[model samples]
Target: MTAEAETTTGSGTTTTSGRRPGTGGVTARRWAPGTQVLWRYRDNAGGRVHICRPVTVVQDTDELLAVWMAPGTECVKPVLLDGSPVHAEPLATRYTAPRTTARARWTGAGVLKLARPGEPWSVWLFWEPGWLFRSWYVNLEEPRTRWACGVDSEDHFLDISVYPDRSWLWRDEDEFEQAQRSGLMGPEQARRVREAGRAAAEVIRSWGSPFADGWEHWRPDPGWAVPALPADWDRAPARTAP
Candidate 1:
């Protein structure tokens, strides 16, 4: 999770050039649907991976990258060093407290993550146990940097929850503020993240492509197997041309 130099696109997705998967040659290519890849997030204080989920590619193209995290998939997530849930810790010490990674099954409903290349945030769709449409979560963060293994980004600690009625509410403002106070994010970075959140709100208001698209009815392919968490889940990702 080294901080590699990145170029930003007009839409704000991060781009870099490096090695291609399967081929020793350097090139950018879409991951075929059903391909298993790791979607990871680097720790806020350090560039080490703190969150990693193995997902199956639903669709991949120049416009969007869609991945499905099936229920019960094993994943890595941060927890208090004492083995408590991070959220259970008080906000005052949440960001500053020491933490470690833990492996756990992705309980509850699966998630469908949709990201337009260069967008500063990704939209995650959720459902209830019976496939009942729940809501869309706007995760404000750095645009994903594509690599041979998968994609990586740093979470901004801010988010938006969009309901089925098209209504939305800001989420994690306290965490965002606390993250800055804890020095995990600088003032300038926080400003950019706020700007990014606003941009996402604008899209939600306008009822953009993803929201307008009928993804709520979409279902995972019955033949697609749940992707397994790889042994090297935290392996360094090789940059790939966008």
Candidate 2:
């Protein structure tokens, strides 16, 4: 999930300016590294969206796609009860309460999200400006379903962050638990989320494809635009294939 700069199209690989292999009228092209793209997630299956960020592409290949969400960028995130942290509120009022957009900047260095085709989760690496690796955040969510404009997935709420030394901790256990209590996620679904976290930790410990990839040294294209929040960002068709 991440856009536009000089690109080339030929053979199996095509630039965003050209059509992808399968889609008829939909233009699909590999966004070059350093290109800015929008990373977003919808709140409901085919309903309104709740999160949006302009991220810099790090790697885009047949195997995996990586993007960086830098700090200080204007981003859209969900807030409950006058900007209170979502986890701090009681479970009963969590979803029933008024939800609003919070204009926020990423506080830390930034986050690098790595997603593979057909995967259920994206392993996000957090760090400071100097590439000081902070931790790997395993965001357990719906497997990303690609669309004409960008990728879409629903946040599963539960997440895990793993340190450089391989130590890991649950980042949003309270929210995950609350969701279950609120009748949002069933026990079976919770188990699946935990399993996904463990799988991501294994990848971290082994220094997998993305961690070993040269993304830390990747830089954004100087001419890349600061992507704007589109008015139709929240809108998507009723069905999308992953």
Candidate 2: residue 212 lDDT (0-100): 72
- lDDT top scorer: 1
lDDT of 2: 0.69
User: How does candidate 1 fare on TM-score?
Assistant: 0.89
What lDDT tens digits, residue by residue, belong to model 1 across residues 55-90?
988887667899999999999999999999999999
Segments of candidate 1 deviating more than 4 angstroms: 1-26
Q: Write the per-residue lDDT of candidate 2 for residues 1-242, one digit (tens) a residue.
A: 22334355432223554333345545445656656667788774234678988777767754687877766777888888589876566766776677776767778676778898767788887766677767667788888776545677888887877766667777877777877876777889888888887777677778776667756565555565555666655665443333
What TM-score fits each model? 0.89, 0.77
Model 1 lDDT at residue 210: 94
* Superposition error at 49 for model 1 (Å): 0.5
